[model samples]
Target: MTVYRIPAAYLHQIEQELDSDEKETMLFLCQDLVPDLPVPDVRKLLLALNAREMLTPVSLSELLYRMKRFDLLKKVLGIGRAAVEANLATCPQMVSKYRVLMTEINEDLDKDDLTSLVFLLMNDLGMSHVKMAKDKSFLSVITDLEKLDLVSPNRLDLLESCFLNIHRKDLAKKIQKYNWEAPVHPIGSSLKYVNTLQASFPKLSLADPPGIVNKGRLKNGACNFQTEQLRMAIPETGGALGQVSNKYRMQSQPLGVCLIIDCIGNDAGMVARTFKALRFEVRCHLFLNVDSMMRELYEVARLRQHKNYDCFVCVLVSRGDHQGIFCTDHIIPGFSLERLKSFFIGDRCPDLLGKPKLFFIQNYIEASNHQETPSLVEADGGLCTIPQVADILWSQSKVDASTLDRSPNSSSYYLTTLSELLMDPHKRTLPLLDILVELNHKVYEWNRTNPAEPHSLLLEHTLRKKLFLSGT
Candidate 1:
């Protein structure tokens, strides 16, 4: 009879004392441990043990010692000594197959393949199975495994959407990698910086234009010495201020910006130039009247989240005699200042204070006339008169507190009529320069036709003087 010799290490361990049952169990486990061994070799070992009929406790212990010496006991019977007993209690063959499968899968999976497999298992697998699978719980686990060395520009939108849905705040922190900070606006440029900021930071939210209560009144209130300087300045000032507010919002880096321009004949080219200089990217929502502008602002504010802006700039130009009422008790009754404060203060670094929030009012407010007269003396410079037309007009208005209480028809009827005329489509179609000219012509005709209000004559004189001096 030919005898096959096991390795010396196995032989040394097998020489020790072992029980018969232990020897049979150890031999079974050892066969399972040798994953890719020839079936013939396994059968030979089993047959040799059977032929001997030495499967006693001492023999089993000896075989177990041999398996242990070869460091195969753990692989064959799982981790602990009791694990082998547990395996035997269940379907032992099934447990053996599970061990083999785990080993093969571990060796076969690369990082990318593992990530894809995990994603497949998580997204495709049933809820019950996912709950049971320990490794498939976290979706980010796969992302961690597959992240590239260089930053992937193509993944920005994907990352933004994912982070937004996932509520991942850390995404904002990663903005530095893309250099997404606010840039400085160019000086002395006529471009609207607010619009530039809007274009650059698409994520920010901006206030809408101020609301206009009496669009007709705002348009044709009074061009004579009878309009409030503040009322006249309010529309243009509000626009400038609104731009500042938008700039602040964009600096905070929100999700989107909104712009509202409510003026009959706005200098769109000037506005475009100003915005370009400021590097603001803005999308404009234009409104011809105050009611529509205010309605939209209120709607946006009411529907949008608390920190979002609702009212931005309201551009109300008065070519005739009316003032635009941006915020009113009726439209947004009981609208809280606290809410407005939050709009500006919601961000960690608030950008709304102590800046150039107002601009270009002197052009509109100052009397347009300033010319050098003949010098009284050879050394003396020419004398010039600079009448503050805005102040004089505001002071001379006949609408007192009592008049304000009456209907719009009762208060300054001529101003009201002019407001109505400017609101007409035919009137609005004229260019701003042509409109000013036409307005002067109309005032001259009115002075000729009507004699009750001598203020019209004064207004005509002032306008003509300004036009002559400015050479417009």
Candidate 2:
């Protein structure tokens, strides 16, 4: 016993409406029918037929033949000549074999068939492949099919996959041409100034004096005597001059000493020796760790009085690796601007905006091969006989002797040990601050006489002006 499905009461209602001779109702029902629908209720009703028993092949064929004649199937399926041609090109079996065998009788397709085709292309094949196909005609067909709601959700993933496979260079060019959105955070303006400084002073070569060693002890324990020796030799060595004297006198009073040690490890000893040589009464702090140094600096600055030791003479003992200083600035645990200020300038000093506290860094003071003559001319308006003076000016100016005639009183000196020491791989020396102090004193004495000729009349006038200005 086989059970058969019926079209139900709605189909009967539809049939009665169609048989009333309503042309529009008949046309709509005729176009709505398909090969898949076995029973035609309206036709069966009009013929007084037992639709279930009339399942014979001939009967079904005649019914479909009449339906096709009204052009109802073609209008309902919306299968035009162009659509049929496109379907035939990609899928010949739909019309050539399946349609003929599946249908009870040959029939023209309605809009339903076209709608089904569109849905099939969209859900089954995926849109990305259709878009990528070499045939433009297929793409146009797909575009039309999409209007009927054919494409599926998985099409987006297929499109992304296609884009990812593009050549790297092509992708890069496309990216370059594209306008990029600005980043949220831009670099600070201070970095530009720092970069300019780095560009201007690409390489700064400094020198250290000879006979100064890293041996924890000086051969002679006599600090005053050693200081005198440094002082005495400075003039003869071209370290003394009027310009040098004026420069030192103009520098603001020191706040504190900044100890910058290099990789050589003996900078502590160097600092101790230099401080002793200069007769500066201050305790030297040795920092193996950056945190301790920062803490000490702050603590000392916090003290209300006696903040004269604010100048830091960073003695970089090692050669070539300057990055350590940057690392120290970043990692040092305790650093305060207040401490730096108190240390460099005493509490009595006015805070001048944008003035960097003076720092005198001394390193690599070995004698150099370069030599220059002093530009010191005699009071009689003739050049001095000191060959070292000439050598100094020569070394400093890098100009030929012809240029020396312009500034007669200009005395210059090249470090005696600088040329050779710079080439030497192994050797430790004194801090630059000590050398500068010694040089300053020597220049003061030299300028008191000879080319500078410190006049009593000028001194008296200067003293009078200072006293008058102070209202004393």
Candidate 3:
């Protein structure tokens, strides 16, 4: 018995509308699918349906030729849907084997939150003191774990076990209790910020909140859209399309970076040129005597307008302290880091919901970085900011007048080194952490050798994937 999955009524409706040549082509293409219908007639039906935009262009040929293009087929079959959907590297047992080199994670290296995590795993947990800590095979596993694109819950449990074994009950408790999926707490916050804002709104889900589809204008095109579209866009590291699906090949994510420099005594052109050389279409806004709030609004508006970009880089070069940055106009009110992040969230800028957002700020004073809730977040039915929200990254320039190794570069050392690292042909393919690790090394060496007024860059990022900017 020959069988075809396509409906008989659908075939009949389309077959009546095709031209002779197109009908012939459709029949030839559907030769294997339907033994009941002749190749020629099948071609007629295909062309007929195509005229009404029922099928995609070259879609049938792609399905036929690239039957094995679905790389996830085997994985899906081997495990249940949950296992296949769990975006993780090896398992807990596998991660447990890598605890030997845990002590080597130097806490002194000024870098991102990921590096700090390694420090917590290595030095604080004392994985190096375990039975097989010095084994060569154990060290090999550590090397592999470092390259993983994400830290899954399974891996977190393994690290937690290491903490328990070392009698660090407090550290173990914190690890077990922390919610990785929750909204990230503002930097230097004493308490965590939960998604209470969702209860008030009750409408904004993890999916597109609003403003994405442009109301009545978002037509579902060749893509499967709401059906297969969501799964297809899952962020897969080491792939050209980070979270974007293959169906939308014509659409490309743009390279964007916003540099807000308060150039009272700083050079803006030098930084702009560096970012441009790195293929970043940079937007430089100089706030010489303008109110700081206006500049913040400008950024919020721009972020909303260009939410389709794969990555967002916001660099603030301004004076002031650890708490907030001051504009050149000497305004009493300044911008807080958390407040800036709120403007780009899903509730406000729904288009950029799951994308990566990077922030680099150079401060001029020492002040408190306490978590200050923005009015928008606390408003009636406002959205709560969650952790791991679209891969938030933050890097701050720290200058110590106390340390003898502190020496300030005439220009921004952090930006210069980071720009050069991003464009380095040899190392450009590496993940964001790998690049930051390189930057840390460069700055570490620079301060060691110079030592006039020592400078160190504070790196902290909560991005959940391996970010690679290739030729961008």
Candidate 4:
């Protein structure tokens, strides 16, 4: 007898209706069982569920119910809300209670709440992870924790402590509730308990139980290894859909200033022209040394010109090591990426406050043996105000240094592709997020064809709305 799975049309219909936040919420709830998913599309998520043999009609209904997507539940599953609740009451839930609790806590967290949480976890998560999480959702932070083996069903102590530190007593209570109702077993007993669960509910597919030897393998040959590193490489948007209201305001005449710092003096003209076509006033600074570059950035950040604009874009094309980008003097380590963005934060550039600050960094990395020694910048302890990194979109790409030896007229793959995409009349009307998704796909395709000199692009943002550069 063939087991029943959700129909492809039903998955397509459900995927169509989910907004960005709803898709992220579903991914959060499924993170434990289906951790480190590359993209947040509803269809791929459901397929993962099915692969684990957990995508039963009842489990799907429960997931939709948890998401409060009753319309999909009723329309696609032909299951009523009450019926789902009743079924959940009688049967075991495929998604773990811990994930559900985490999802609820995430839903309750606002921007300030997430900021406080990141600050609290700074020491534990380190500067790199903190920087990545600063502009992302709470679920992204939790996903990292899951990757590091820091959070689990039995590992609520650290999370609960963070919640309390953030002054979220109500969210803390949810964690406490999970701890109370969920069974606590010694690490050694996880396998036995998993076996017992399988025996009790054969269809129940739990994520790797804490302390299970295999870590992330299913009993039925399912490969659920959560590759967190590759998550950003793939496009998150998946594809376009009907227009939605959740986008950034980009209606200003001169959208904003496009400040291009081209160290090699080769790509600034092209990049400058691209943003200019999008209604931005372009400022190109070519071949600046460290001191001059810093001063120019400082002046740009304080310029009165920002007051007339709706957005700000900074393009940096240079050589770089792991710690920071190199200037004309490549022998010494130059400015850290964080330091570059610091000048335009709310405190320093109040005019650009609440406006989107977009940074596009394309750095060519020298061979490892010739790379500069990486050093910590903020090694000295000092009292300084930490900027809230909201309304900023950061896109960085690292390419092989050999690419720089190419024809001077030809720019780097990332900047060239970005300029082409922005200048494309067809894509100008699409939201920046959608264009980025396509860019990521194009880069992946390039990597597949030329494995020797591959490129990587990372998109991280705290923009609260969609960004359309249609020049309307």
* Global lDDT of each candidate: 0.29, 0.27, 0.44, 0.70
Better of 1 and 3 by TM-score: 3
Ranking 2 against 3 by TM-score, winner: 3
Per-residue lDDT of model 3, residues 1-472, tens digit only? 3322344444454445445533443343333233244334564545443443333312332322222223322322222334322422221111111121232221211234334344444643356532233332322234334334112212343444444444444554554334232333222222211110011111223355332321111133211223222122333322455454322111233455555554433546666765566556677767644233443443454454454455666777666545455666544344444555655654344455556667766655533453332111111121223333445766666553133123333556656777778767777777777887777778777777766544546666656566666632
- Across 107-144, the per-residue lDDT of candidate 2 in tens digits comes to 22234432433333553356774444323332233333
TM match of model 4 to true structure: 0.45
TM-score winner, 2 or 4? 4
Candidate 1 residue-wise lDDT, 288-357, digit = tens: 3333443343333333332332112222222212121222212212122112112222121122222111
Q: Which pairs of residues have clashing backbones in candidate 4?
A: 247-465, 247-466, 248-465, 248-466
If ranked by TM-score, best first, what sequence of candidates would result? 4, 3, 2, 1
lDDT of 3 at 212: 32
Q: What TM-score, over all chains together, does every model reach? A: 0.18, 0.20, 0.41, 0.45
Candidate 3 is scored at a TM of 0.41
Candidate 4, residue 334: lDDT: 55
Best by lDDT: 4
Ten contiguous residues minimizing lDDT sum, candidate 4: 195-204
